[model samples]
Target: MINIVYVESSLELVPSEIIRHPSVRRNAKRKGKPPEENLLDRSLHHWAMDRLDNSEKRGRPDIIHFLLLEALGSPLNKTGELRIWIHTVQDLCIYVNPEARLPRDYNRFKSLIEQLYVDGRSPPNGDTILLELRKININQLRDSLNPDFVIGLTSRGEPSSFETLSKSLCDFNNPMVCIGAFPHGPYQKETASIMNKQINVYPEPLEAWIVNSRLIYELEKCLNVYNSQKIL
Candidate 1:
C-alpha cells in the first residue's frame, strides 16, 4: 500500500501568490516591465492574481480528481491502505479519505476546496469524504505517518525509471510518494530536505496528474495488488 502526498499543492481557492510562476516573468518581458523588484513589490502587484477567477489558466490542483479516478480503479481503494494528503502553500494540509466516493460533479469538488480555503477548516458536510484540514508541516506528516520509505518527484533529482524504483522499493512495506501539486516554481527546499530519495522520471517536468497516475499504476503492478485480475 502507498500513500500519495502532494506538497506545496496549488490547491488554494483564491489570492495565491502568482509571482512565483514562470509565466509572470514571461509576461513581464513581453510587456517590457522590469523583473519583480522584490517579494513585497511582487506580492502587492503581480502576485495578487486570484486563481478562483480562472482555475485552469492559473493551473489549480485539479489533479486531485484524476488521482481519485485512478486509485479507485485499483484494489488500493478497497483495501483501505490508500491515503492522500494535499499540503498547501500555507501549510494547511487536507487529508482525503481513500474510501470516500467523490461527487460525480466536478463543481462539488471545486466548491469543497474553495470552502476549505475560506473556512480554514473542513466543512461539516454530512459524510463528506474530505476528512480534515490540519495545520501541519512536513515534519508532522513524517512523524505521524511513519512511512517505511519516502520518494519525492522533482526535476532537480536524478533521472528515474519506474522499473528501477519498483525494484528498489520492493523490500519496503509501506511507501509514500510526494509530488508537488503546484503548476509553477519548483517545490520548496524544506520539502526536498525531508525526502528519503528523489526521482526525476521525465527529462523535463510533466503534469502532476500524469506523474502521479503513472507512478501509482506502476507501483500497483509491482506490488501485485491491482484490481483487474480480481474482477476477472
Candidate 2:
C-alpha cells in the first residue's frame, strides 16, 4: 500500500488567544457553537488570525478538505492501495479510514472535524472507526509507518514527473509521500527531517489537491488499477 501524509496541515480549533475576537465570536454564534469549538478558518477568522503566529500559513482546513475529497473518491483509494493521514500544524495526527465517506459540504466537514477534536474519534462510541485523532507529531507518525521510503513533495526539491516518481515508488514494498497542505510556507523542521528524498513533481508550484490528483492517477496507472481502460 502507498501512504499519503499531508504534513503540517492548517487544521485546528480556534486558539484561545483569538477565540474572543469579534470575527471568531460572530462565526461561532452563527454556528451555534462555542468559539473554541469551531475550526480555525481563514475565511471566517482572518481578522482574528492576524495576531496569531505564522498567520500566512495557518487556518486553512479547506486545503485538507479539497485534498481528502479528491483522494478518497479516487480509484487508488477504492482499490485499497492508498492510506492517508493528516498531520496538522498543531501536531495532531488524523487517521482516515479508506471506508470513511467524508462530508462533501465544507461546513459539514468542518463540523465533523471539530467533533473529532472533542471526542477523539467520530461516532465516539462505535466499534468501527471512520476517523480518529491522536496527539502525535509528524516525526512519530513517520517512525510508526516505517515505510521503505519517505518522499517529500516540495517546490524546492529535485524536479521530476509523476510517472517517473511512481515508477521509483513501485520498487519499494511501501512508500509514503508527504505533501505540504498549508497555503504557504515550507515544511516544518521536524517534518523535513523525515524525508528519505524530496521531489518536485512540477516546475511551478501547484495546489495540494492538484498534486494529489496527478500523483494518484500516475500511481494508479503504475499499479494497473485502470488496466482495462485507455489512459490517453
Candidate 3:
C-alpha cells in the first residue's frame, strides 16, 4: 500500500493561550461549545490568531479538509492501495481509516474533528473506528509505517515530474509521500529531516489539494488502477 502523510497540517484545537480570546469565546458561544472545544479557525479567530507566531500559516483546518476529500475520494484509495495519515502542527498524528467517509460540509467536518479531539476517536462508541488521534510526531509516525521509501513534496526540492515519481514508487513494496498541509511556509525542520528524498512536481507552488489530485492520478496510472479501455 502507498501511504500519504500530510505533514505539519494546520489542524488543531484552540491553544490554551488563546482559547479565552474574545474571538474564540464568541465563536464558541455562538456554536454552543466551550472555547477549548472549538477548532482553531483563522476565518473566525483571525484577530486572536495574530498573536501567535507564524500566524499566517496556522489555523487552517480547511487545507486538511480539502486534501483529505481529494485523497479519500480517489480510485487509488478505493482499490485499497492507499493509506492516509495526518501529522498536525501540534505533533498529533491522526490515523484515517480507509473506509472513513468524511463529511462534505465544512461545518460538519470541523465538528467531527473537534469531536475526535475530545474522544480520541470518531464514532466514540462504535465497533469500527474511522479516525483515531495519537500523541506522536512525524518521525515516530515514519518509523511506525516502516515504508520502503519516504518522499517529501515541496517547492524547494529538486524538480521532477509526477509520472517519473510515480514510476519510481511503483517499484517499491510500500512507499510514502509527504505533502505539506499548511497554506504557507516550508516544512518544519523535524519533518524535513525524515524525508529519504525531496522533490518538486511543479515549478510554481500549487495548492495542497491540487498536488494530491495530480499525485494520486499519476499513481493510479502507474499502478494500473485506471486504464484507457476502462473509460471507453
Clashes of each: 0, 0, 0
Pick by TM-score: 1 or 3, better one: 3
**Highest lDDT against the true fold, candidate:** 3
Tens-digit per-residue lDDT, 89-186, candidate 1: 65567777665566557656655555565555455666464557787888788778898999888877789786677666666777877887766566
lDDT (10s digit) by residue, model 3, range 1-232 = 8999999899989988898899899999999999999999999999999889777768999999999999888888888889999999888899999889999999999999999999999989969999999988888999999999999999999999999999999999989999999997898888999999999999999999999999999999898987533321
Worst 10 residues of 1 by lDDT: 37-46
The per-model lDDT (C-alpha) reads: 0.64, 0.91, 0.92
User: In candidate 3, which residue pairs clash?
Assistant: none
Q: How large is the C-alpha RMSD of every model relative to the true structure?
A: 8.5, 2.5, 2.2
Cα error, residue 134 of model 3, in Å, equals 0.9
User: Which parts of model 2 are misplaced by more than 4 Å?
Assistant: 228-232
| CA displacement after TM-score superposition, residue 208 of candidate 1 (Å) | 1.1
Q: How accurate is candidate 3 locally (lDDT)?
A: 0.92
What TM-score does candidate 1 get on C-alpha atoms?
0.72
